[model samples]
Target: MSAARGGLVATLAAVLLVTGAGCGGPDEPGGGTITLPPLPSTERTTAAAPAAAVYRLSGNLCEKADQTPFADLYPREDAKRLVATEKLCMTRRTSAEKSVSLTIDADLLPTEAAAKLFVETGRRLAKRPFTDVDGAGADAYWDGDQDDVKLTSYHGNLVLEVRAAVNVKDGMPDDVVQRLVRVAEGTYAKLAP
Candidate 1:
């Protein structure tokens, strides 16, 4: 072949090779290399129960008191001088069994006076007919109505009553309730004089 014809043929072959590689068609080896975009760094927050979810009265008192400092009433000195009594029972529910707990505290009051106060409170509670009284001490609970749990604590002359209702379905578990009871008792003990 002539030199000019040979050079032209070589140039044509190189062009075809370059075009085929750049096209990246399915027939081409390695096809098209794809690199995915990076994932997002922002975190997603899920809904959770409030820290004081077990305290039913917390919500109502927060609304009713409107930011009052209720903790001030249960001081350490008062708790030390206070005496506690409690009662416990089971509820009358057939489908789901429940436990009740009731506790009352009185400071500087005579034993008779304290007993009178507890009796009166129990009578009133019976009229309202809430949960059964389980046991008593510095803290107590009525574990009926799975959603609502009643709690009570006393220091000196101050009586703190809490009705914590589990607004969410399936509420808190027994272990959680037991933990909360311990926490409540500790808090009450801290209020001692």
Candidate 2:
């Protein structure tokens, strides 16, 4: 396939993998059971309270991501797409004419209860297929195809979605994608008690 065609296919797959309006809500479009791990003990503190509003920022959401992995991929100066209150952070790094890109979306909830509901909704989404990922967070799943990686994780009062697409013709590496997921999960885990 041409590079452009491959990139388009990869982008579509990433969109589908990261579906649910960035909420990863239960309304996943594909039909498959999503087995989610149990919420963390720290997340249960506010289970009895009413759900709080989901947090959405208007600035650079990528700033919340783990910088270690992305630091080299997207340099600070070149990756500074936006540094404001935007909820979506998308950027690409290019070298020798090859480029790799990523998009990160984080929804911070006002309460743990709200976070749980947000995550549970994604778990219940009968259409989206997700495999329960162990040792990642309170609940987590890794969704991917031939071209992209999308990891959805929830912990404490945070729900995070990490998506990456490398040079489409060359394809993205599994380890690279896993590292991004780790970054997303670890970053959110720190927010908990």
TM-score of each: 0.32, 0.58
Evaluated at residue 164, the lDDT of candidate 2 is 73
Q: What tens-digit string does per-residue lDDT give for candidate 2 at 1-193?
A: 4555755766776666557445643445434343333333434543686443344444345555564565554454344653324456676655554555667777777876787788778756524466666555566776666667777777667677777776568667547656776777665543333
lDDT (C-alpha, whole model) for all candidates: 0.36, 0.61
Per-residue alpha-carbon lDDT of candidate 1 for residues 1-193, written as tens digits (9 for 90 to 100): 5555755766777666666556654542223333232332223123452332112121112113211111222212221212223311111111132222222222233343363476446534542333323323332434344555555544333344543333345353454344334534554443433
- The segments of candidate 1 whose C-alpha lies over 4 angstroms from its true place after superposition are 1-120, 127-143, 153-156
Q: Which candidate is the best by lDDT?
A: 2
Q: Pick the candidate with the highest TM-score.
A: 2
lDDT accuracy of residue 141 in candidate 1? 34
